[model samples]
Target chain A: MIRRGLLFVIIVAALALAPPATAERLIVSLSTHRVLINSNFTGTELVLFGAIELADPDILDRRGYDVVVTVRGPQRNFITRRKAQVLGIWINAESREFVEVPAYLAVSSNRPFAEIAETEFLRRSRIGIDYNILTQRIGTDIADVVPQDPFRVGFVRVMRAEGMFSETPNGVTFLSSTHFRTTVPIPGSAPTGTYEVETLLIANGALVTRETTAVEVVKQGFEALVAQAARDQRLAYGLLTALLALLTGLFASLVFRRD
Target chain B: MRRLERRRPFGPERAHVSIYLPIAELPVNLFVILGLGIAVGFISGMFGVGGGFLMTPLLILTGVPPAVAVASVPSNMAANSMSGTISYWRKRLVDIALGLVLLSGGVVGTAAGVWVFGVLRRAGQLDLAVSLSYVVLLGIVGSLMLTESVRAILRAQRGEPPVVRRPGTHAWFHGLPLKLRFRQSRIYVSAMPVTAIGFAVGFLGALIGVGGGFMLIPALIYLMRVPTTVAIGTSLLLVLVTNLIATVLHAVENRTVDAVLAFTLMIGGVVGAQFGARAGQAMRAEQLRLLLALLVLAVGVRVGVDLITRPADPFSVVATETFQ
Candidate 1:
């Protein structure tokens, strides 16, 4: 009995002193392609699809986090040239947290090619390409990168693609790729740690390859502690109130009658 | 000590007032409630029906608690029925004895209905039952009315007489004992049928949140063979009494009635009742019955369809928790 008690004490001490294990990371692949064009090519547009996967085994243990993707490229030229154009930007994933299971990326487009591009190009092509090209290309390349910071994990890349060439007064005829990249900063309130990161190369609106690296985010002061409490509290209250009011009103109406 | 005093914002003395006026102090959604009242009142007056059947369902659909919807409907119906009943009485059309007898049964039926409502609600079957009943009853009634009305119109256009003769009198009614004299109806009939009808109307009114005017008027005219003029007046009188009782019951039991909501609906109903009474004067008895029957059938079908297609969602959100 004495030996067992001593062993328990040692185990508790070790657990208290040891650093918390890092949460598993998730990698999402997003892809976009432009296939249709109208005369003037200015209206020609691209579509995007995204997919998500667990990067580390431990990712399944951690709470899910939202994913946001922004694709930025020359908007004006693409619209006028009847060329595949990346307009303002596309955020395939909005505010959604997912577990370790694979999730299909929401696929969408700005507008139909016929509607946006010049009428002539639209008449030429009837077939539309799959929207998942970009997600597949980038997601596959970045799957290996582990997040060094348990709280922070993300990647961005610039991709260029060229294909069946066509020209217009506004731009060159060669099907060209649009490139952009972003690095998201984990706020101080985020979990303290380092995270694995990955880089993706995309061509013809598809993720072609990837590069992996480590990202570090150091812990900071009191502000982080306060910020986290505020966020969690606010989310909890908002969801609770809206759901409650809607339900109570419905049930009460059904159950009681004056007569 | 000062800090402790500051922390306790409300003193113990203030607690009772807070409980009594909990909802009273809260901001009311007056516009939405008033709009619903006006629409329901207009329909009720124009159609010469209490409109509770439609109003109660409409209130629920718009997110009012079911208890509140049921509780408030009778009060609203009372206001409208009062105005209409008074006008009919002035015109010397009311059959007071027949109306009183029906009302007696209606009151008892209403009490029983309310009790059953409680039971079904606890068992979680109320919504499905109500919806199914609405659809089935309305579909049958509406089709029959529509068919009868169309036939009447066609016959009239072809220069046929308005009244159709029956071969036999109401012999079964004569056999019933405990006869009562209804001066306005100018007949002596057993009090049993009148009381039974009253009870049925009362119970249905409480369960379905209606005044039972539509049902009562038809029963008086067809089942009792009362004249059309007396039937209308008697039905309206019965509606007034039954609705008054329902309103009182709701107030005492559930405390669900929103006085402000009831007031708003009453205003609309009052105005609509005047116009409705005027229009009713011009319509033939058969025409009016046909129209009312069609309305009932329509409402019934709607309720029934809702039950069959998608029973009420059992898991509903309530008071910061989800309950089934």
Candidate 2:
């Protein structure tokens, strides 16, 4: 009985000390791959269901896991301006141009990002809205700044107010030992584009595996046709609009005849 | 602190009644916009003006982008003035020959104005320019009209006949060359002054989204010595044509006009204009002028206060461009 106990202890220690034979793999599926923005679109929520497949069942029975889901919309450039009192009137004084930044960015996790991992690790991985690099052009220089940078903070604050940039703790919920789910919000003003949804699986404060999926937001129906016409056939569109206004005026004159 | 509250979806509370403007890319309350249109239309119809100066500022206040508000007002002006132009034409009050001469100058000025508008927009100074122009123009015109109308009322109370126009008197521009006779206006004037006046009206109309009726009518009567009826008719015709041109130019150049929004405003405008015309006939002209002057001054003062005061937030943001 003593020899058997020793052998069990050694085996358990070996298993614990050795590197994971196979990393945990992530499989995720979104509720919908396409979000259609019609005249009635007033923002929506997308459900993401994920499962963790363990390669070695005996690796860890504690089932302590963490998840951070990030949804990033198409990238675009932005300009942020600071107003100053000029000649006794407020006007835009200094401006910063942010290049190639996500127009919509939402980072959600099961718990606070700081509780899940070290700040350096989080920054390195770009795991939160604050960690994501927001490139800016300042005079002749083009680079991202520290998290506390004023321009960066202003840009993020404006975007957050517009509901385009957000961070939600406890957004991810674990359904079981191996299953998890989250609801990603798409604001009403969310730009129409291919949004990339990235799910990271962390175990013991280290990233184990990740998976990526995509969702498309598109302008559909009459709204789409109008925007398309305005872009593709600008002259015809303009002339038509002018003609419509003129006809409406003439029609009103005929209907409300005076003398 | 880590857990942030999400924005409430423009749901439940604003559902059903909100309409999505494809170009503006925002949802606005339908009834509110319609009511605004009707209100502005009523004032325009009663005053025999295009009402764009009021409409553009109001649209901006209601959260439409300045570009969209400025670009869209021309179409509404064109529509509003067309009905008035038709009635004036039927009465033979319009001086077509003079109108054509003015239009020749107006087209050039409008083209220049649209170009300047584009440049200002790129520089992000359009809002300031719009506000500053409104304050200066409205302040001067409003004060002038207020004094003139008040003087006329006082003269009537003193039992004095209204001052008569002295035809022999001529302004400095009258001595210029290129003299033309306007049979409808019953005046012989230099085409130079007429064209210059048209250019000014067109520039103001395109840049500030106003019909220039208030300035044009007064200039015609006081400067050109045209009959009051003919001046009103001619000015309405000019506003119609110039606004039509401005609308097309803005749409083609900026692509900022929102058709859905314009249509809503137009429907409300036409209906309210009919009633406003009736109300206008009931009021005396001097009293109406005084009221309009006060309204103009009020708007000017409101915009001026906004400029001088500190804004709620010191930072503003704009997307550089759309990806597609």
Candidate 3:
């Protein structure tokens, strides 16, 4: 009777932490284009625009879930727009090749698609600079870019969704979704940095989510760095050599003293 | 965390871990150190040599730094030498005057040797020179000693008395001006040879980081024609004085002495010496010579092989501008 009671308690705890039976599906997509502006603009400017759709539309504004878009390069920042109108541009403190812009929308609204699109929807975010005047900006050169084969940009969706398996009696497995797309920049003699693509999700023509991802640029090869360090610390090498010599002598003295 | 709780305080963490302690806390490892001291001490008592040639290397192998190993050698020798010399002195075996003269010459030679050492260090050639010299000198000496001892052994086995013939080289000593009498050696010789030998041994001792006892004992016995017993006693006396001086010099210049390590070895040496002395009493002089010769030869061959093999890297390379 006591053993049965203990087993029942364990089973009850496991069932309480188990994930919900239904899973929410999310879809994400990205697009890219070069906006050719006047010759006076010396840099590349990036703008991220995208849409997201959720099958279970009511779960959009869950407290623990977030959607973010990022743009990255050697020196890049973010500019956001709300209601199809420009909001403000902010200096990107964490400027690498990628910068992230994030947006969140609550799920409780029940409105028509046309009404949602007309009601001051978010639009027109710019990453690097204004698209109309691009050439005057100090951007990366064409020849000095890192290979894009290993570089990547992507989005990940983390949900509070959970699940249970019999083998893991005390643990619950959570559900997550990810989507990514990246393009390699042409290598040229330009200042090196990260370049990226960013996107926002639109559900029923209303802004619902955003995400950021990147491609990297680098300068020197790996082996070159090691060779440079060796050249710089020659004295340390010499000292190591001398210590070895002394060790050899001592070993010799020990072995051959009885000649 | 559970394993950490099982560790005991003041226990051997590893076979050769270095332990640091204030002087007051030294007694923890004193027993093992005392044992090493006794072993080397007994060797000193028996052979009347400082045993520094062996001690310095052993200390280094036991994880003491080279500079500290070299510097601590003299102090260790002094302790062993003092104990051995006292016993010999009690037997009325030491020649005080002869030992004093050798000590005086050793002091002067050591100064010169230290200067040469400094110059070689600056030139970045000291490591190579010292190692090569150790191999050359010890190999030759050890081989000669071994051969002589072997011959003596063979003669004894054949039940023949060993022959001793005086070398016909008295002409070399005739012209030297200052003549001195050494009652123990029973010779009236010019001070030049004694002084020269002292200087040579002193230089070698400094360079090799030994107490010069091995060199001094052999030179006294074979060249000066001192009796074996007298040579042993006088050698110990000279070593005691010379090593004391060297220890002081090393302390002043390099501050390389590690008192803890020295004390540990000395502890072992002292206990070992008592047993070694007892063992020595049972052995014949020929047997002792044979053993010493074999030991030295083994050391020499080891050193020589290293020197002849591929060139080795140096321990330190301080950059300096060369005019040329």
Per prediction, the TM-score for chain B is 0.82, 0.93, 0.83
Pitting candidate 2 against candidate 3, the one with the higher lDDT is 2
Query: Quick one: best DockQ, which candidate?
Result: 2
State the lDDT at B118 in candidate 1: 64
How well does candidate 3 score on lDDT at residue B214?
80
Candidate 2 residue A109 C-alpha distance from true site, Å: 1.9
TM-score (second chain) of model 2 = 0.93
- On the 0 to 100 scale, the lDDT of residue A35 in model 1 is 20
The DockQ score of candidate 3 comes to 0.01
lDDT of 3 by residue, A50-108 (tens): 33344555555542332333333333221111111112211111111222211111111
Better model by TM-score, 2 or 3? 2
Report the C-alpha displacement of residue B258, candidate 1, in angstroms. Answer: 2.5
In candidate 2, how many clashes are counted?
0
Count clashing pairs, candidate 3. 86
- Candidate 2, position A152, lDDT: 88
Off by over 4 Å in 3: A1-259, B1-13, B16-18, B21-39, B163-171, B309-324
Number of the top lDDT candidate: 2
Worst 10 residues of 2 chain B by lDDT: B1-10
What ranges in model 1 sit over 4 Å off?
A1-259, B1-32, B164-168, B282-285, B310-314, B317-324
